[model samples]
Target: MKKIFTILLLSGSLLVSGCSDWLDVLPKDKQSTDMYWESSEDVEAILAQGYSRLRTCVPYIINWGELRGSSVIVPGRGTKTGLIQNFQVLPSTSTVQWGTFYQVIGMANAVLKYAPTVMDKDASYYESRMNSHLTEAYFLRGLSYLYLVRNFREVPLITEPYVDDAMPNDVAKSSETEILELIRSDVHAALATNAAKETFDGTWATKGRATKWALYALMAETCLWAEDYEECVTYADYLINATAAMRPVFMSTPGQWFNMFYPGNSNESIFEIQYDETNYAQGSGSPSKVFPYGTDVTIDSYMYSEPMTLRLIDEYTQHRGDEISRTYYGSFAGTAYANYPDNGIIWKYSGMGVADREAVRTILDANYIIYRMADVMLMKAEALIRIGGSANWTEALAIINQIRERSELNPRSEVSADNINEATEEMLLEMLLDERDMEFAAEGKRWYDLLRYGKQQNFKYKARFKAIIMENNLTAENKWLSSVLDNDNAWYLPIPAEDIFNNSLLTQNPYYE
Candidate 1:
């Protein structure tokens, strides 16, 4: 096994410089190999760099998770994003390069391999603190793989750090099942740590770092993706039950919902990538750049991506009305565009106000929340619905009603637990999906939700998913998209052509090939 000294020299050099606010403690000057890992601070600096690497993937997350879905539109006919929304993505699309995700995985692998040496070197670095840092490394690595597996379907799973240029680069792809099992294993390791306590006394660290609750959230979400309904419900219940007493994770009131984005790290936030403008900028990936905000709604030059679709806007209004809290103002802007409600701007990340757009964010440091209490609640509900029984349906309905109540919308009165027959069960499922659509619109979840819905039970709802694509796209494009999406392999992105050219073991996704 390589010693910590050499590991630091080989891997730690890549992490010495970062821009995150918490990463300020890292040494600006390069340290000698022997001097590194002498204290717990050294371990923490590596972990912080892992987090910073994760932040770089947010733009790809937003693009992969939303652009193809029926929520927001990307402008510019020849732009990469425009091609994606139109389902014309090729293997050479620049957005599909997943090197940043691998960088995050590399940082985590380094921490997991080298951080333990700090306990021996520093008297103050106890087992508990070491375990906490290790848990965070597992979280970051697992989360990055989750994103990769979801987007590319099959990807190279590299668990060890690349210590030198001589290391083999032609790693073969792992099946989705294999990748998911690794994620599960990582989650289990994270949860078993003694330092994986639920909260950091409601501080920013609680939401910013990995904790027991965050582990459970990841488990629940991954289980849902894997269609392990019982396991999903079990993990979700861990969070639901643990937070019951202290209520550490509660839904933010509608009036205060936007706070979850601007000046982020709200009570509902389980885990989010931290960003501070003065120290760390979101750069081109900033929400202001992706979904640019301006007083003039019709200026196409100002828009990098197209505005939120009117269908999404109508769904919000139908569910929550013109309430200033979440519907009209908090989630979207440009209500003054009465002639074209379809041009409503996504306001969640770039605006700060309730009931009205009070101020547009110029700093563009909004933290990209990965999981929150509301999303977890919906995951549990969807799991229960998949399990399928009157009691389970009833519980799921209650959860849905609770979320709707928080949003100041009426409880779903049409579907009842008593009459959960086949027809009503379908209705309940659509209702739950609609609630998710309304609640999480423009939050980079729409496409994944649609894909999950479509792919479940061997593409049972695939038509519904295709119809959504048709509904949101131009009539002319629908024929092409519908024909392309007929093959299930098209749903996942093509592995970038550059990666295939560089790696002998690589293979292009069948649809793209």
Candidate 2:
């Protein structure tokens, strides 16, 4: 399960280093009128920390994708063992104890509140740069809350961001419907907040940041979850029309594609987490390190190898029958990269490949990207298909083909109702998944895709996953999480018990019962 990310409601007023006052509405400790955010640097640092939280943000999506996807199910506690197995019935509150939402929410709230106050008093502080900085807080705060509403179905909508001792004894848990509505409201307000309206388009101080379009792109996604097809199309279209510079396309090789994730590579990204390996200890710690290639250590370190499947390597070509020589590489013998072995052993964990063991590492510079242009068009296409049906297939196919051509492939000439009918959603979804796979190959999309497709818990997943690992020489152990109950409880991750005892109004998820 994706760990729930909630900030602890501190009993005392916390003078924390990382988060800001925008989120912590009322720290239990009394504040000094003497201390207030005054400079752009102060505003920037506070917002930077808020932004950094997105990297380490542990929301429901991670769990939703990892545990509840279509192909896998909670085995009978046979092979894998843990709560992830019995997910469907797990209590939502179990995650509340250690969830990331509260912390983010707290920070976001603090930023939104204090940034305005900080920048408000002096007109000089309201510089164009500071305006955008203020807007960043809104974008982040709204984003943090959206993740909250999606995963748990309900949570305390804390605008003040912090939980003071005086906070109501009975904090209300908004229902999904209510929570979603609240999310939309916040999103709408974020869209309207006047930030760097004219200067945001330029990116020197503002590189790798959010604009009104970023919020719109996200709004489109949120609308899709609500099944508001029209709204989805509208918001996505707005983002696409607005951010014309961020055109996205897939690069052919893993090296080319993976390198794009290096920090500040503004190829297609509209918003991303800026990680300098040396400076930031935030986010999920570079997903690449945690993924298949990551060396395995049992709370320790040792080299472990995970290979990509022949099926995947095979899929890379797009065309089924390529020459045998070009199909494989690296350690696999008798293939292009080599020429001697039985099905090739894996080698993503190239820790042994590290040079100068004692050398200090600077920035690995990889970012977890959230929005890009290609997805905007595709999202638009999806909405078109839903709202306009086959009549709009031409537009959808056009978008898909534009992407294909970018990768040096041919575009389709026809996109008819019949063609739309013949090709299934599964096929289209595969296209989306494959695009995500290619662009974010090693960066980590496998788990999330599975969740959106509702395939993570399908029992059929294990064999499917095993087939890939065997061919790739990958290790399936760490990649897959085990569960406790055979039932859906495994699907619903355990809420850290801390939240249960504190929040009286919050009910336990059915699985917990």
Candidate 3:
């Protein structure tokens, strides 16, 4: 059973229970924090609430990762999403708030605080179980903070729950380096425990919970962000070399990849936000709500959003012709576009065999993906290229070839050692980046992949983004896009003005000011 993200029954408890006052006033309507952690089940319920908070953050995560990516072509020029994609958001704009993430972090902190207390109170509450709970808590907090740092760049480091004014409320933002260090500490603590135990309470915790395997994947991803390629290789190797049972397998073929989305939580999934149609009231929040489908979309007629751009659609078209793209990007009447290239949309997250827009309800239970094996394998390839020099070129090419072969295509002729050795570092990096773009299309990995490249002393994403958008008539003259390309600070989002207003000591991101 997928135990990680089972429909949470404890949200009501979260609202009514435990220190509603946040200080000394214990809950009157529900269990107090002291009473809540009395059992592992209770701890599970609280952690479920934290997961519940994460569900709310899914769309925000997409926005931060994909909107400004300039991949999607939005027809609604004045729309909020369009503005964000063009990098025109203002500090006063009520977008991309970090408040919800802090809520998740806060609940995670509560877990860390009380799980140990339960162990002290009951002899049956074994140390291993307590450590497991603590490990999950740290994973949740670390993951949340990583998202925050990625989007906002700098945010207050709140490790403890807010109890009273005696604790600082108006904390200033910390450097990305400092935030990353804290993330490292949390994941490291999680690794220190027996979380790799893989199963808990007889449920497949590997799929649902933060198994040691999942934490290792997260650590590798985190290390990549920190530009610690060696550490990335270390953790990637740990996961790659895990027992055959633990190792994430590439789906049988490129065709099976589409199945990963239709019926998610596949063997390849390292970690994903679980959704149950029978249990989850609002399945996957119907990504259609965010990406948008035409009002009258039906199975017979095409229904896609404008923001999903012709560029992305063309890329999808190319994939269809070459390898394993047909299942992913289908045409309504053998024509790819519902309305030509302008209204093209990625149908992966839309639903399964959706007969109509309303049929989306039938397949709403989508697992918000985090890491998968194919993506990780390519990541390791990039790490090898970055750390091991020319000797590693052949190995990296072999890894990339594995993904290509999975798609039923022969390896690129140019990826051989001689070609790789002769290619400039920029050329090799660009090749890797483009490969990621194709493999991870619509997975929300593209923008971050670009940003990761840009973060390395020299800026390449600016040129790449500019070149891509220049092809799109919609963004050809976009002034906001021009500003973002010219200025480094514009890359990170502005702290919502409301955030700055509420926290007097908090400063705005320098670019916004």
Candidate 4:
């Protein structure tokens, strides 16, 4: 909590540049409190900083979102993600620290609180522009809280910026319901702004910053997580029927699909954390470093050293014969099944071509995509299935088939829509889950998708969730891991011990305590 109050410094150069150069402005000095909120560019710098801080959370996102789920093999004991993979997470584990997210929230709060005053000081800072900046602030804060509530379940809801050391730091955790309500409110507020247009004039700003499409995507995702099926479907349709200029569509060919990663900000990207190797170098924190692809790359330098599980690999091979664009030499790399143990590298963020291993990316600045077209399509399909009806079932199947066709797989044998029942619903739900698994593998979404499924209707799919774990696990401690997953509270991460010690009002999750 004390860390949240630390003031973010800005450079004088930041006030004179345009949006494109905003990220280049590094912090050089703390601003005078009376003189800072006088220009629109000052607002842009803090918004850019919000994005910069969000990029720092990518490593944690990938680790927490994938390692705990059944996709990759476990890391060695001394590696950073090993504890998470082994289900040995403690409050002291480094990955569970939520400080970076708070930093993002703090930047957003500063913008929301002070950006309005800019209009009073500068004649050029119009109301429309101020509203646009405010919209982005709400979107960033809402998006940060969404990650927090998902991982921690209950967390201290900090909205106002802490400007000085004298501010109180002992805020207590809010209930999950309260946190979710706030997220919903923020999304709605953002949507009401004039700046919430779907596409910005520049492609980079459209994808890198929050747009109307991004706001709708956030609402759809939040509604799905909250179990508001009707609302989820409605918000999803807003994106599904977005204007042609901004609407994201699937890549028509396999080679083009790789564009979503390599040069990023593809037609399909709704929102992604922008990283330019020229100005914002990824250093050792790049996705290429973590999921490196060659024999020459040393394992000790990377945090995760395992290949995709055979279970996930077979999912592609068995269903779509020779998944040229999405599996094997595509989504992951290896000559053949025999070479998988040492060579099944995650190729999405590292490879320049689907089939060519030699075409590896030299620059390590692949944008971390938060949402894309396929993700929204699948989300809408899931919500429709949850709503449950003959009409809804038929629509969901059509959507699923569209995705399947894009992946080069045959359409699933159709269930009679008129005879829709619990059995057909369950079968279709499984198909949707598998499709998501194949579509978003190693993209930091597998674990959250499983959690949403398992927690639906108060653990209705709990047995199925355990079955997935049992089927994919090949470790010596499989039984122990299964036992740990039996406790519902065990699914979420514990609040960090340092945060608890720093703020006496903070409490550990009961499962950890």
Best by TM-score: 4
Q: Sort the predicted structures by TM-score, highest score first.
A: 4, 1, 3, 2
Off by over 4 Å in 3: 1-35, 200-205, 244-246, 284-323, 326-339, 353-361, 458-473, 476-479
> Number of the top candidate by lDDT?
4
Task: List, residue by residue over 43-130, the lDDT tens digit for candidate 1.
Answer: 7777776776677788888888877874666554557776667777788888777888887787788778778887788899899988
Q: How high is each candidate's TM-score?
A: 0.89, 0.68, 0.84, 0.92
Model 4, residue 228: C-alpha shift (Å): 0.7
Positional deviation of residue 155's Cα in model 1 after best superposition, in angstroms: 0.4
Model 3 Cα lDDT, one tens digit per residue, 353-423: 43342234344566677788887788888887777577776777788777767655556665576666676
Q: Write the per-residue lDDT of candidate 2 for residues 1-513, one digit (tens) a residue.
A: 112232222222323232222222232333332254555545555554555555565223333433333122222322221233223233433423335555556656665666667656656775556656656666776677666654454566666644234445446567756766766776776656465342343342233456666777678877765657789888887755554443333343322322343333455555655554443343344433332222122322211122333433543355322221111221122222321122222222111221221121233434556666666666666556545555565567667766554444445433334577675554554555545443333332344443334422244344443332233322224234332223333333444455665667766655565
lDDT (tens digit, per residue) of candidate 4 on 1-513: 677545575756364233336544555677765677778888888887887788788888888887776575443544557677656789998877899999889888889989888888989999898888888889899999999998999999988877776578898999888988998999888877657766766777788888888888999999999999999999999878766665776665645666788778998888987777755454355566566666443323321223244544554665554445566544644454345444545677777755555687787777788999889989999999999887898899888878766656677664644555544667888888877877887788888888898898889999898777656544427788779889888888999898899899999998899
Going through the candidates in the order shown, the clash numbers are: 1, 61, 2, 0
Alpha carbon lDDT at 370, candidate 3: 78
Note the residue pairs that clash in candidate 4: none
Report lDDT (CA) for all predictions.
Answer: 0.73, 0.46, 0.64, 0.76
What global local distance difference test value does model 2 have? Answer: 0.46
Q: Counting only residues 3 or more apart in sequence or on different chains, how many pairs clash (N, Cα, C under 3 Å) in candidate 2?
A: 61
lDDT of 4: 0.76
